[model samples]
Target: MNGVIVGVRKDSQTYVNMKRKACAEVGIMSFDVDLPEDVPEADLITKVYQLNSDPDVHSILVQLPLPKHINEENALGAISIDKDVDGFHPLNIGKLAMKGREPLFLPCTPKKWHKDKGAKSSCSRSVRRSNIVGLPVSLLLLKADATVTTVHCHTKNPEAIIKEADIIIAAAGQACMIKGDWIKPGAAVIDERSQRPEQEIRIPIEASKVAGFITPVPDGVGPMIVAMLLRNTLDGAKWVIGQ
Candidate 1:
């Protein structure tokens, strides 16, 4: 598998490192295109187009939280949908929302929540509304006939909402914001928020004793993200060779 990553933030360096480690472990060839924070949107789009045309590149990932000057939609649009390993392309998400139409790939993080982990019921709560994770997971749960409640900044009594969910997905990016008491006993929990090491350890350690299953910050959905990227790259490579 071969892929290219475009990023701007110093924090994004960690993602690059993570991806590299994952690629190395799986024997996937990787390439990176790190741009300055001040890079023009057009230049970023151009870079994506160039990688899109490269025969050796099976997947293209443009890291999120791009500089203000760069329009994320334009940058992501420049990538070939077939090579959208991150699965953030509009078409991929659109297909995910439509019944009976399979997306080329599911967004890595959200896709992991499809299975209910020994929860007492299929009632689920999503703490975000982004196209990437929250909405997709909610839609997938709806498709699976699970009762889904989506919480956002405007939601009243978010804790009470959480208490009703048999499956809880915290992707709001607030580190350790969700507590053990917020979780129903025996509930399945997926926390995708990352905080500092000390703070990150708190949620899992606390929630594990309450929730039926808790995904630790590092070993949980994090590794699955890299695995999914490789999987999508392999799928893109297969499509390229008409296999």
Candidate 2:
């Protein structure tokens, strides 16, 4: 898949080498770009769209951590939904949130005029973490075919929202964000980065008593998302190839 790696011009050498070396071993095409000069957010998006619209190009990835001045949200919005292998397109995000209840435009056809095309899904809800570490929870629930709700460091009334979820995923990078007291008592809780610094750490509260099928802090949901990205890429390639 041809892709333009935006935002990291000179520093992109390492990642390009890495992608080539890694994908070459498996005989998969690794496409890219390296925006060496610091550019405006719109310019970065324009470059990505140029490559994204190319029929020969199947995927587009803007290497993230773009320069501090660039607007990341807008640049990310530029990628076409069908080729959103990184899974950041708003259209793809909306489609995922719908859980197949709504129609997003497939690559072959125009669909979904405005945001109001679908019925409500058995929607996912969010949990609160005290810190900036709850980022990976969405990646975990994406595997369960559940959308992630955002109740993070800045959110208020975290306790009340935790009760609404069919699933609860917590990775606040804190010791424990959701105690057994805060949960719905039977929802699934996945801790994606529980064992990052150490293999064993005590949870602040006993969630297994309240939650159903709680993931272990060490080996639960972390590896699954890694596998999910690989599976998505492999699965998506067949569709791009019309197989």
Candidate 3:
């Protein structure tokens, strides 16, 4: 979880080599699961259940959009919630919606995490932001310890949403969406612009250097997001064992 942990793949030799190198560096062992496209739904379910039952299998993930006949809902339901690190467990959803308790697997995205973890905290302050994308800025606001009351876009009152955040994460791609006066000034102004013009790159905020930890344009959050997904996979494995 700490270092760059990548999946070792059989598809491409390059990925396999990269994964092996990473494994060797960290003294991690690689497990090979037979990923046959031709595998039947029952067989796939059986294999997934096998992994769920295996103590050595820290996590079991039946990749999304599995073979058409696999009956995704049925297969997913068959997976033990404790092992459903992807958080597909019906029980997890139940807990999230009803109990307001932590799901067996929580989406690590900042905003999602905040909504769950920050539920108990009071919304003491507000910061308005226009985001290029909605979730990222909401995540930044959550990370900054600001509980977002509302999130809106150009179609709605962009300023109104910004006015709500104590720190405005101005991500709405509209150039110059937030005026200088719109912000609390010296309040966190996270402006995410382009770093890689060819690609839609996302830079994250460095909480230490910036006004108070902002998700910069194309750098910070994306990398962290990958790491979190990996973590969620590991946690999902743990959840299955609990069941």
Candidate 4:
């Protein structure tokens, strides 16, 4: 199996390295394309097109948080849905949202949480409107028969909405934003923030006392995301080979 990873920023490079390492361990040939932060959007799309046509490249992943100038939607849309290992392609997400239509691959972080069928019994998504995490996750929850309420930055009385959820997915990227009092007692909290010293704790310590289950920022969703990425790559390769 073969996969191509394209990344620009320093932090994205770190994630790329982790994926490359995982690919190696799984015996998948991985290729890297490191562009400057200021690389032109057209050039990036051109590269994606090149990979889309490469028979050997079964999966293509564009590391996210592209430079402010680059259009994230355009970049993600350029990827062939068949080769979109990150599952960020609009078509894939569209299929994921519709009933009886399965996406080729689900967004990895949400897919990880989706594995827990129990969590899907009832869920709430705390996220900004984005392709990466919030919307896709809410769709998945809806499919699983969970009533999902998406609480974003602009949502009024976000805490009151959050406190009613049985499961809370914290993907808002704000540190300590989901306070202990915001959680419903015994609610499952999945924190999807990237780990940083200042933001080591995504959900505050007091949250753990009230939350029945809470995932740690550093050790929780990050590793699962990489694993899901690899799984998606393998699945993409299998589909190509008629497996």
Candidate 5:
């Protein structure tokens, strides 16, 4: 496993460290490239390409929030799809949302919530339609034979839509955006929003009283994504070794 971090923002630094710790726990060899905040775009992309070409490197993670001057797409696109453990490549995401096609890897965060069983014949509401979370989760639910309704900022009567579903997944990145009343009683809820100071603290407290199973913000969804990344790295290694 290798991490290429550019310019160190707090979130990027924290997550890279978390990945490193997880790598350590799982016995994956981890390497990092901490470039200056002002590193040239070409230089950064070259580093990613180098990692992609290295046979020994099974997984490649470039922490989010790259420096302002960097072209996020070009840098991320330089990574081989096979080594895109973060699953940010357009090809990977496209295949994930489409039917009858499999991606090299599922987006780590969303894959954990994309259940193969138990959600069948259920109606689920997914908040946000962003590529990373909402869209993929909805596709996964559809693959599981569940009816999925996606709600975004522009949706009307969002609460009414949410209350009708048997499952709710909130990934809007907004704090306390979905309240307890929005969740159907006895419904399973997965909250994916995380921000500093935890402005969304009330949802879990309130939802727990009504929800059949509620995932707490801090201990709930985030750790699963980390585990999936590690699992993806191991899977990537297996693919590389043809075992």
Candidate 6:
């Protein structure tokens, strides 16, 4: 199977490199398309279309946080649903939100880890409502018959809402945003925020003391996300091959 990654910016390059390594480990041919930070939105969408038509490329992923000038929705929408291994297309998300409907592929971040960790029946709270992770995950939890409360920036008494959850999925990009006091004792915490050396604590160390289970920033949800992406890519390839 073949996969193509389109990445912009330094951090995106770093992420793309990790994905390429994962693809290589699994014997999936990986292709890279690095566009300049200043590349026009039209050009980026054109690149996606090119990959979409390539029968050899079974999966196409565009690294997130494209340049400020680019429209993210337009770029994601350009990817063919068959090859949208990242599962960000509007149609995919639309299907995910409805009852008795399934998207071609579930977004990687919201797919596997929770089930593996046995959080399906837990009362869950998803922090922040961003399309990338939080919103989709909340939808998944609801589908699993888990009661879900979503806490966003506009949420009043956020701590009170959070304390009631049996499981928390924290993806608010702000470092140390969810304090120890905000978490319920013995609750499971999945910290999905990415970390940098300068900002090592996405969830404060104190929160770990209070929570029964919490994922460390660098080594935890990050690797699982990549694994699910590879899984989705492999599934797409199998579908193409009539498996």
Of the candidates shown, which would achieve the greatest TM-score relative to the real structure?
A: 6
How many steric overlaps are in each model, in order?
0, 3, 37, 0, 0, 0
- List the global CA lDDT of all models: 0.78, 0.52, 0.46, 0.85, 0.78, 0.86
* lDDT per residue (tens digit) for residues 1-243 in model 5: 443333334547777887788888988888878887778889988888888888878888877778788888988888899988878898988887688988888888778776434778999998898767888788878878889999888999888898998988888866677877788889988777642234454255677888987776566677788888988888888888784
Instruction: Give the per-residue Cα lDDT of candidate 2 at 53.
Output: 72
Number of clashing pairs, model 6?
0
Q: Residue-wise lDDT of candidate 4 within 40-127, one digit each (tens)? A: 9999999999999999999999998788999999999999999998998889988999999999999998898888755446766555
Pairwise TM-score winner, candidates 4 and 5: 4
What is the Cα-based lDDT of residue 198 in candidate 4? 38
lDDT of 6 at 237: 95
**Residue 184 alpha-carbon offset, candidate 3, angstroms:** 5.7
lDDT of 3 by residue, 134-178 (tens): 443343344445566544352466555554444544444455545
> Which segments of candidate 4 are over 4 A away from where they belong?
119-123, 194-200
RMSD of each: 2.5, 7.9, 7.6, 1.8, 2.2, 1.6
lDDT of 6 at 75: 92
Model 6 TM-score on a 0 to 1 scale = 0.94
Report the Cα lDDT for candidate 6: 0.86
TM-score of each: 0.89, 0.58, 0.50, 0.93, 0.91, 0.94
Cα lDDT of candidate 1 equals 0.78
Local error of candidate 3 at 242, Å?
Answer: 8.4
Q: CA shift at 93, candidate 1, in angstroms? A: 0.5
Candidate 2, after superposition: displacement of residue 194 in Å?
4.4
Cα deviation in Å at residue 124, candidate 2? 6.0
lDDT string for model 6 (1-243, tens) is 999999987667768988999999989999999999999999999898889888899999999988889999899999999999999998999999899999889999989754565556778999988898998998888888788999888889888888899988888877777888888999988877653344555577888888988887566677878899999999999999995
How would you encode candidate 2's per-residue C-alpha lDDT over 72-154 as one tens digit per residue?
A: 67877787765555666656645544544431222110111011112134345544432122332343244345555777767
